[model samples]
Target: MLLQLISHSLGWLSAQVSAKAQDALIAVLSSGPVPQHVAFILDGNRRYARSKNMQIKEGHTDGFYTLRKMLEVCIHMNVRCVTAYTFSIENFKRSPAEVDALMDLAEEKLLELCQKGDILDKYGIKLVVVGHRDMLPERVKAAAEKAEEMTKNNDRAIFNLCMPYTSRDEIATAVQSTIHERLDEDADDTVTADDIEAHLMTSLSGSPPLDILVRTSGVKRLSDYLLWQCSEDTQLQFSSTYWPEFGMWDFVPIILDYQRKVWSKA
Candidate 1:
């Protein structure tokens, strides 16, 4: 019992020290340019679970907490908009049991965000679930809607959860919407790139232009996430750390590298 208590104490002390160090680093980074909008392709939860000899669900849970911690740092650093690739449309091909587990987890997290005094409420962050809502389980979809409604009035920051989404689908949907609008208005003008962009999920959700996109687990590909928004100016960062193990230290260097690029361009 004493050994366990001592171990817990040491862990707590280490976490406190790490957090203080991170805060100091953030303070210094804040004085320079910070990315106004950031996107994350959180990858490798299953691999992380395997590495830790844990269940896949447990790895996903840890990934969720890592996302929360990362968001706290982004918010503290005054990042105006953040987007996460929470689930991909391709993920539906996984085993039924795994998909069901993920749905349950999504519902639980969405409902938690809807609760008063939660992170979204406390930070005045608007929660936008961007994707094919009809594809979600009824309960999960409802929870997502509730979370969005609960935080609709917040303007301080935007948190976009792209669940069961694909860039091709988003773009196709935007194109269809743009065409339909033009048809409804009986306009002779041809559809423009700007018109489609105006109907995009990100733009409709009022998310700022993406400045940086980071994919953890050393993945270098975009994997059909935010394809249209990743212009030449967007910095793409790939980290070797898995999503569940990613921390503030893993993120700080990406920010610094982005700053360096921005400086060089100037």
Candidate 2:
């Protein structure tokens, strides 16, 4: 009993120390230019689950907690916009049971965020669900709309949750919207690149230009996420850490490297 107590105490103390160290580092990092918009491609939840011999749902749940923690870190860093590639349209091809589990989780989490004193309320962050609403389960779609409506007035920060989304689809939708609007106004149907960009989901949601896009589990590809939004200047960061295990420390180096590159360019 004594040994167990001592071990627990030490663990608690170590965590506290680590947290303080992280806070100090963040403060220093904040002294420099912080990215206005940062996007994350959440990957490797299933692989992480398999590695730990746990259910895939448990891995996703763990990833959600990691995401919450990373958002808090981003908020502290005063990142104006944070976009997470929560789910891709291609993810729908997964087993029906897995897809159903994901939908249930999304519904639960969206409603939880709408509750009083949750992350959205605590940080005054606006929750924007960016994707095909028709593609989501009815319950999930309702929960997403409710969350968005509840936090529409928040102006402190913006969180774009991209689920059931694909860059190709977004571009096509934007081009279509642009052409329809022009036709309705009796203008020529020539849709310029700028016109399509103005109608992009990210633009409609008021998200800032993406500055950095990080994909975990060492995945170097964008996987059809935000293809149009990623300009030549956007930094692409890849981490070997799985989504479930990603933490503040894992993110710090990326930010530092971004700062170094920006400062060097100046």
Q: Which candidate is the best by TM-score?
A: 2
lDDT of 2: 0.93
Kindly report which residue stretches of model 1 are placed more than 4 angstroms away from their true locations once superposed: 1-8
- Reference-based TM-score of each model: 0.96, 0.97
Error of 1 at 39 (Å): 0.3
What would the per-residue lDDT of candidate 1 be over residues 211-262, giving only the tens digit for each residue? Answer: 9999999878999999999966788999999999998878988999999998
lDDT of 1 at 171: 99
lDDT of each: 0.93, 0.93
lDDT of 2 by residue, 67-182 (tens): 89999999999999999999899999999999998998999999998888999999999999988879998999999999999999999999999988999999999988998899
Q: After best superposition, candidate 2 residue 209: deviation in angstroms?
A: 0.6
